[model samples]
Target chain A: MMKKSDLYIFAILIIVCVLKLVQIGYSRINFSTDILLNSFKKNYGEHIALKKDIIEAKKLLIENEITNFNLSEELMSNGYFKQRIVEFSYPIRLNETSKAVISLRNKSNTCKLKSKLNDLKLYEC
Target chain B: MNVKSTHHQDSKLLIICLLISSAIFLNYFFWAINALSFLKYVNFSILIFLISYFLVSREFKKYNFIKLFFLSLLILCLGSALTDWDARSVWLFHAKRIYIDNDLYGGFDNYMPELMNAYPLIAPSLSATLAKLIGHWNEIFPKSTNILLVLPAVLIQCFFLKDSKFKLMWLMFILLFSGRILINGRTDGLVAIYFVSCCLVIFKLFIGKNLNFLSIKNKKINRSIILVLGILFGIILTLLKNEGFVIMFIIFISTIFFKLLTKRNFSFEDLFFWIFIFLPIIIWKFMATTGGVYPRIIGFGIEAVYSESLTQRIIIRLTDLDNYKLILDYLILNEKFIISLIIFGFAFLKNFKKNEMIFKFVIFNSIIYYFLLYFIYLSTPHDISWHLNSSAHRVLISIVLLLTYFSILSFQGKKN
Candidate 1:
């Protein structure tokens, strides 16, 4: 019912469509990481988490110097810290202000923790 | 043709249309996803569909499917490349600020106020809307949006031309060759679309015999609509970029010249037409001059009012010819396929004399319009490449429209 040339054109178009779809999928995956970085950069504007701050947060979680401690839900929500926490040494209660200080421990070390309890205020810490 | 054969042809036609539509949609889908601005993409898609459906339905008999398919392919490549072209850096960067800063009127701190002042508001406004809707204003969204602007221009061109062999060839040639120019998302694409729409409206009013206006035996409503559309388009052109106003003026003047050269009767309608077209310019100029939005240039033989500053020197340096040549080289090399198509367009001019007078008029006006732009750029203080890069390919939009019209006319003639 269809000419050979017409079928050939259809095949070519289908191929192009598939190729385009794959390209878009690849580009999306490739750029999503950049988008994530851009989102952070836009929100924080060059205020990267210093190595000292990360080390201090980790140290505080390990040592009991941070008693009656509170970590804001914000601290837990920050993508960087969420992925880092290994195990909680103490049961941390979320305050009315959404802040909590908990002793956290890994195989390495501990120190006093200071963080806004509210999830939204985590970026500030 | 047998009934079986007719059914088969219909199926083939359906397949072709679906493929073309899919290609367009795929490009748009990628842009929307990349920008994370699905709503804005939807708005643009609706507009594209409406315009494309109107043209395709109206002019279905005029197209040769195979030729148009190739032409569409060429255009698709150009449109997609807008997502990454370096020359579009300024616009793409500006779109980010629309969301990041949330202030549209003031110049973004990174770009010069003068440079920012020159941009038309529509594309940027649209980009900003996309940014807000998406909640992320990155470079990709704006770049993708700019690429989408090509749809209107392509749709309008398809609408005006009748179906024919020459039309197919010309359409293919123009679409494939004008790649570099169309993808940049500058004001030129909008101007070209506006110019073509104005021409189509004018043609329908003055030349189309079937449409009766006011039920008067000889009168037509087309001219009235054309006059109104021309004024609206004129205003739009002026607002889009500073040079848009100049281009509109050239087109208006060229139309008058074409009418005269062809010995077409100059009616009172023509006078009213020109006046309506100038209305937008007059209003904008009045506001600009009196609103005190810009610094007044004042000087005398003995004294100067405003201080002569080193700032002007830097502005001049940025627009120099060397910068233009670099951009030109970039576009030519990057868009080699499109550039080749444009070269082929030159050969079609030899067959021009045999075409209808309206077709010839459009071609003549388009040539003069581009030539004047080149001349003005050579003489002006601005960087030659910046001016040319900004506007040259856009000029091809008008040529493409004219060539399509001529092709249709020639094809119809051959059939007869």
Candidate 2:
């Protein structure tokens, strides 16, 4: 019942879908580290992790591949505004090229993490 | 066609639907102007608009597909967490600031200079409206507004695509193009939808005869109604994104050429109406520039362009095959672009003789848009490759959609 051209078109579509899925999978693996860094940087002050221990929380983030964390919402609801620069060590191997440096300034209320990735070389924050 | 006199009620209905969508978008812009003083009022108004949109979407004869589109859109929005840096750093962050401070420029300190805080506020204002309605900002509601803003354009498209085959093709196109970026609170996808829809509307008004409701022999009342709707869409298209202005300009300028080629004069009244609608954007830009919030383009300085290093940078980027290869890789990785090219090829073959002028207009616009993109890349002072890597694909998404939409319009359907 199927025409040869129809079969060919179907095959091409399947191939395209497969290629897209593989591409997405590859990007997820690659950007996982950056995503983790961003979560920490965004929620540094307003999250529950800030009230307990900043360095330990960041350590968890750096080690794990967690993409979504609401630590800030919990911390803010509990009445704590994190306003200190909490520095911790992270493996350069975690993200070979990208480096995230998060500094939570007390006076500025601005938590910024500078992340730059170019060549596949390890760097420190 | 026997001197068509009666109105095409379906076309009028389509125009009303588009107007409702434009009204909602413009409501956002209105809030942005006096956002601080009228914060609560704007939020309340936006609530009303959303409710109205839900009720009005049912007014269409075939509302099932639109409902499915929204349902799928909701699923897509909730499925993914917002991890895109641009979404968090710029768009959603701006929305959160508006929600907290109840003003457009709420958290100015958080705005990086490069984020273009002064860019038109349609996307951010709508996001803020959604956050206000939900009573809090967690990410999902604010980002969902992207799909909400595009819903009207989708509805207008559904009207044109009455055939089952065309409907299926459109659904396939939507699924293919609605990848992570579209639902992830990005303006690029919103911009693409608005620009393509605006072009399609313009084409229908000027060159195509499908909008039989808007025939020239209609009463003066109908003519004025068409003029007002055309002006409103043109303005909304310009306000959608900076590139939107360029796209609309290309369309407008090419309209003149196409009209002349066809031995007809481009309507001066339409041009005047479009400019009148565009006055708000000019005023917005003037205010931003005067307020010193807008960052001046670094590469625009003559001294910079003539600088030996800058010239070398431009030359290197222009001559590099690797840069072209990077774009190709991005396109190839996404099946949407390949399919768009294939559809365009088929459409061109089918409509080559029938709609040559409009077909040429579409191709001309695309070639010019591509060249403008390349020039921007060459002139940008940022890390050229990084800039392209991050944005080239996003912008190309718009172009591919534009081409696909044009092909759909050009294809000789039974209705056409």
Candidate 3:
């Protein structure tokens, strides 16, 4: 026959087991806001500037300094937008190289944006 | 003459108890918020109290509760300190991966899929659940989570030791003090508990011929309970780790071997018990194999280039003595060795007659299982060393269970 003491011990053990299960269950419902923020920062932060670069590259290509441009392919491959541009001032005096200057400015602008985005805190979205 | 000795002992016990309580309280108070969730820490405290209560009040009535409590605390403290170095970053972090994704099958993207899936789901699943609930799956949570996993086994151990006439208090003290238990929280501890429970149930049911099936006695009900408990224990073992199934298989085979060797008539009830114990394991194996949870071996076939390469790697690693030494050190020094010794001692000393038969069968089966795995590891193509190291604890679950059973059986004999 099962003794009363044995039953009590069993009951206590069962209660302990139930308590553990409940505690574990309770902990599962809570989400870590910090982890979510960190994940968002890691995944999304790197792509932000690459997105802006495509836009700037598109504007520069439309201004007609660079030629033989395919924006869709460029955007797909290098995050740079492609567009046709006519230019004649290369290998000449600084004053006449307005189109070249515009292309240089666009390239630098994209590069600067990329670097700035890279500088953002990894865990900051 | 009696009052003075009693008064002195009571004061000594009170002091020891106070010290243990303070130490545990302080330890928990400091780490409770940062490492462990509030509920988990509290639960752990409750568990310790329960263990102390059982051991001091009933099992070893001669021993003062306070002294045993202190000894347990010291053991835990030492074990934790010794094994605390790299586990936080390795196993505990891996557990966090399970929690974050909430898919035990979804392999850790950072590690190889095979390597990631090598670990059983129970420990990680529990950690994941805790992480999910706590809102922060930090390193501390998983490490501290080991306490819960170890509790059932420890409690069952107490039950096993209850009737033991030996200085079980000292044995408990030694087991607790053993450093391995403190170091890492893994699934092997649970496996040990399950194995011990299985033995206890088996012992309770089949120990003496006094409880025969043909007799109009409680034997029938008892046998049914044993069958149910054995099956439940086996399923729990299988779920905890893949090696758990191996242990169950060994136990089952051992039982059959024992019956056959002894010339015991196998009846429907015996068959039913075996079926009950083994059905879940077989079903699980089928599911695991079919589900592609583990790689399946078909008929003997020629090895591919990749398979050949893996075989070479496994061979080289196995041949390296240094690697084996490192693994042995890691496993033995950690809580497993002490626990195993105590269980083995108890089993060898107490369960000498029929119980020993079961123990020997189990030991034989375990040896075979271990050797088979070793041979397979020797032929594996990848860094089997890394895989083995990671899953080492899981492998020891059976041994732990066997020892636990022995310990329990030893104590159970004391009652008679």
Which prediction has the highest lDDT against the true structure? 2
Could you give candidate 2's per-residue lDDT for residues B232-347 as a string of tens digits? 66666676667777777887776666667767655677668667767767776676666666533444322343354656777877688886776566545556667788888899
lDDT of 1 at A52: 37
lDDT of 2: 0.57
Question: B247-359 in candidate 1: lDDT tens per residue?
Answer: 66766776677666656788887777767666645654554445344321111121222233335533554467675565445333334324433542543454444444555
Docking class of 1: incorrect
Q: Write the per-residue lDDT of candidate 3 for residues A38-123, one digit (tens) a residue.
A: 42231222122224443344344334334323222222233112211111111111222222223322233221221122212001
> DockQ for each of the predicted structures, in order?
0.04, 0.06, 0.02
Residue B378 in model 3: shift from native, Å? 2.8
lDDT of each: 0.44, 0.57, 0.44
Q: What is the lDDT of residue B400 in candidate 2?
A: 82
In model 3, the Cα lDDT at residue B103 comes to 48
Fraction of true inter-chain Cα contacts (below 8 Å) kept per model?
A: 0.00, 0.00, 0.00
Positional deviation of residue B121's Cα in model 1 after best superposition, in angstroms = 2.0
Give candidate 2 regions above 4 Å deviation. A1-125, B1-12, B35-58, B106-111, B213-226, B266-268, B295-312, B319-335, B414-416
RMSD of 1: 13.6
Error of 1 at B349 (Å): 7.4
lDDT of 3 at A66: 40
Which has the better TM-score: candidate 1, or candidate 2?
2
